[model samples]
Target chain A: MRFLLLVIGILYITPVLALSPPTGRVLLTLTGSITETNAGHTAKLDRKMLNALPRYSITTKNPWVHQAHKYSGFSAVDLLKLTGGKGDLLRITALNKYVIEIPITDFTKRGAIFAMRKDSHPMSVRELGPILVMYPFDDDPKLKNETYYWRSIWQISTIEVLTSPSKE
Target chain B: MVKWFRKWLPTSKLQHWYVYGLLSLIVTITLLASSILLYSYNGNQATKQRIYEDSLWNALQFQLQSYRFLNYLVQIDKKDLPLNGAAYTQYDLLMSRVDLLRSGEVGYLIRGLTGGRTVRLLNIITGELELISLNLSKIEEGDLSYLQDMTTRLKQLDNQVNEFTILVSKGTNLYIARQRRALGENLENVRILMMCFLASLFVLCCCIAKGFSVFKINQRNNKQLLIDIQNIHEEKAKILTLVAQEARPQIQALLGVPCDNTESSNSIKESANELLHTINMFTDLALIDIKKLSLDITTESLQKNLDDYVQIFSSKLQRKGVTLVSYIDPALPDVIGLDFKRLKEIILELLLNAIKHTPEGSISINVRPSSLTPTQQPLNLENRRIGILQIAIKDTGFGLEHAIQDTLRASPTTQDNQPLILQNNIGLGLSLCYRLVHLMRGEIHFSSEATSGTEFWVDIPYEVSQSSPENISLYSCPDPKRALIFTTDNHLANALRLQLSSFNIEANRYLEGPYYDDEDLDLVIIMDSNLISPEIESNIKQWQKNGTFVLYDHQLTKDVQNKAYAAKAQSLSFPLTQSRLNGLIMDAFKTD
Candidate 1:
């Protein structure tokens, strides 16, 4: 009976907890298996909306970039928790429609950040970001390899979360 | 084989080599194991996955987006659609991928594969897309010129992008093959190392096994050798007992009772005794072969035995006119524990050898306690030294030749390695005596000159019994007479002093010459009578005065005897025994 009430409570409170619609140009979208929404099932976020949620900064060397840079944005784990994400997998797509599925645990375990700004300025498309999922490659030597480098998807546009068996 | 190696492999000296060999083997094994581990570690480090897989994605993504944007443009021209956000977004996607080819990990990969052709192509595509994106709003319906131009370029770009994708796939496959081969080499090295480790371990175990086997064999051999030595001792004892009981009496019985012929009778007895002596000697030699002979320790009165033996030999010495001088120490304890039979054999052999060599000269046999350097005890020892007995036999007829002196110089060893002279250039009888002295843990050596004499000295250790002969008061029957000793030999002089002291005689010795004037002395005694000269004769005449008895070698010519008689001196054998000294003192005092 308590579980049912908690479910009802969450459902009723979910509409109130839902994100406000993006006010400026929509830059990123969160869809599928998430509770936080603005447009029925999708949460469209602009730089203001993402920056408004929470923020962190990382100064790190990346394989794609020529030099070390500072990126500020919401952490993937924190962003997922804010959206009430319930999933085993996060399917992220870049602006070029290049898609890759990363385990949600990868983001939480590695502390990858979805960066909206570089060097305190909003990143342009030419910078490989409107928002970039920048892994702290310099923080961990293991991230220099192909397995983790593929997970550092740039120019990230959308993330559709869904549940799946861990073995696969 | 092990015996050979035992001699070759010296102990203690080669011990460090053994340790060094083992240490070197361990070092080799350690180095080998380290090498195997290091190789595998480096191989793993070398094959660690790198980020070049992103290049394959970049190339394939670029190809797909090129055609999609071109098809989107064709649709916009055909459907008469307005210029919109989708065209710009698609253009922006194309531009970003081209930028990645120009600057990202993809750029690094493409330049290595085709010398930057794909990157240059992507730049051209980037410019084309940018131009189309700017003119998007100016496009009017039925004006498909920009669309036609872009589609043709997209077709050309798509084919080249597809080629770049194939090139990347081949390169990735080749790199994976090389890494797999390196991993295979590391595994092979580990396998070889394991095999070598097992082989060396097996070799070490075999060597240890061999060492243990050799040690056990040596232990068993040592045990067998000790048992054999014990058996030899038992067998020799049995043989000695058998000879004493069975063979000897029969040999003694071989001679009939003596007819009334003194010389012939003496010869028979001498022959039988000689045969018996030979048998005893061979038996002792057998004992010497095994170990230190077990002595039949008996408490013996050495004085009585020496007296009897001297009596038996005196008649024969008389026949040869070789005056016998024998002195037995008065200080000898009345009874002492000794191997008397062996000592008798030694004395008999030495005396017989002396008699055989001397035709007509003085032979002196002196028995006294020898004061060779004492054992590691205080010099005094509270006067408790029941001393080592020394018997000296000197014959004045014929001295030893040079060859025999060499043989004597190579003295006999007392151990199981017996004197080789038993079969060497020495008389077999003396050789027996040497073995007998050694069996008693004593030493026998000789000094001889070519013409004067040879002296055989035997030192035999014995324990004195509690009963000693009577002290000075017991010999009160003798009137004390002054006797002057004249001899150059220190040993004979000392023996003569001991013998004279036993008789309660006042005796003084001059070792170099008679350089004093003591006219009251009753007798003048001299040794080696070969040492007597006119100077000694003048001293002797003055000392004896009324009647003087002097000693000189019988081998001297009549002229020497006449000179002694002209000086009113009587000649006697030298180093006088106690009884002879007693008789001489009685005569000297009677004349005085």
Candidate 2:
């Protein structure tokens, strides 16, 4: 009984530390180039060019989804510019070794983005943060299927704009 | 008054106030806690919901940014460069941030970032991304309508998010208002309950105050009653003292002149007779009150004590022309408290008055002794012998006025129906006699006329008993002719010797001393013996055993009486009057 009470006391006080915002470290590493699709063309952007664009969010549902969830991210075109990429097709690889190809023109879609954070915090590797492709499946039922959901890669390690696209 | 009652209330009530205060504190604490909890919960829920909405918003924004970047990549065609360079690395990091937002990694940042319209915009952006990812390489130049259509959808989505946010804000305001009203009602109920408890407590205090006031008033009234009783006692004491002081001297004067002077018997007798006349006058006044008085029957001793009263009065009555004749019935015992002496004096005074008034008639007093006749049959043996004494006094003189005669007849009917008609006018003398008789536990009756005098009768009841002869000695006499002479005064002894000369007594006298020898003493007459010695008494006893007659003075000590009885001597008290002396000598000789 005494031990149980002690456990409850600790549990009751644990939220104080857990509920506070994380401080001190901001960790994100990207080692490959990115591409942008803007005004029906593939374009390359530097970090300064990407930084100059207004920061914003779009909260909505999507349709090419499996496990439907609300998603938040920057547009893929914007990220590619920031990474200095200019190619017709972008090759992306997840830390889990999954790969996908996206055409540069696809990045210019209205609800599409290359997101870096969710709810103001970096995502864990298992949570598919630091690099991932996502769609708001909760907003569009059409996106909550295997086709669209599979293309949204998580644990991404690299994105390279390639001209010699054998598969594409 | 309310304040005073509050003072009397128990400390418990004060403690109750503190309890109420504590309850108020608890309620306030609860309200504060509830308000804080409501604020926190609303904040938490709003933050969570906003995060979900804003995540969609941010994901859409990221999609827009990523699309532009991808377009730039295609336009620039810089695929050969490493993104790790300062400019490229920064762009890669920005791309990573966009990826994290799309994956919902910074979900908390989405709070306040987007709403319903933004959520739709996110859907449009995600759809566009999906379409481009799949079919951008397949689109011909004429498919430009697709990009235009996607842009139109994105703008519509943004508008929808705004509409949703407005609806949520209106809902939050309603929730807050309802919560505030609930809190207010809870506080109001607690306040009302506290006030009711205090009011009831105050009423209880009032009851206690009323009870205490009643007790205090009763105590005050009791104290006043005690004071009143004390005052009444003091007043009675004063009245008694006044009565004693005013009446004692007068009553004492009525008792008589002192009998201390013994010069001549005649002179003494004459003085006594004079005192009797004054008593007679007092008795006359007492009777005058009776003649006109209306009162119930009263006892004689209560009127005045007469055993010691008449001797002094009778002497005075003898000097007057009237001779007081008395015919007393020896059978009646004295139970009536009529002062016998006082009654006699009053009667003698009446006789004198009758003698003076008529100048030549006799006043004969005949008293018929009364006895109890059982009105109901004898209830007990003791009551069968109960006796009564009645007395009547009749006078011969010039008779009564007719008016007085009628009044006498109307004197009030007796239970026995005895007629009493007055023969003379009602005067001080007649009235006095009537009252005196009435005082004897008896009623008065008169029979009179203008020519013949009046007669008065009194009735009383008493237990009559015989004078037992226990005082007479029963002794064996060898000679039956002895005479006994008893005298205590020396002068009386000489007179007794002369008085006994005619009798053949062996005359012996002892002087008042212990020197006399008792050896030859027989037929002993103790005259003037004082301090009789035991040796003399022993010798007298020897003689008495040899059949000598023994008599003693009244002054003999009680020890002598015991001694005489031990010796079987006949003892009697001494100094008999002339008539009694002669009678005693004759009885003694006859007994011998």
DockQ scores for all predicted structures: 0.33, 0.02
lDDT of each: 0.69, 0.47
Which parts of model 2 have CA positions greater than 4 angstroms off?
A1-168, B1-316, B333-361, B370-385, B400-403, B414-441, B449-452, B463-592
Model 1, total clashes:
1
Docking class of 1: acceptable
lDDT of 2 by residue, B224-339 (tens): 98788557645654554465556556655644556554546556556445545555444344333323223232233211232233233343333442323343332333233223
Candidate 1 to native Cα RMSD, angstroms: 15.0
TM per prediction: 0.44, 0.23
Which candidate number maximizes DockQ?
1
How far residue B10's Cα lies from its native spot in candidate 1, in Å, is 11
lDDT of 1 by residue, B484-509 (tens): 76655554555566566666666777
**lDDT assessment of candidate 2:** 0.47
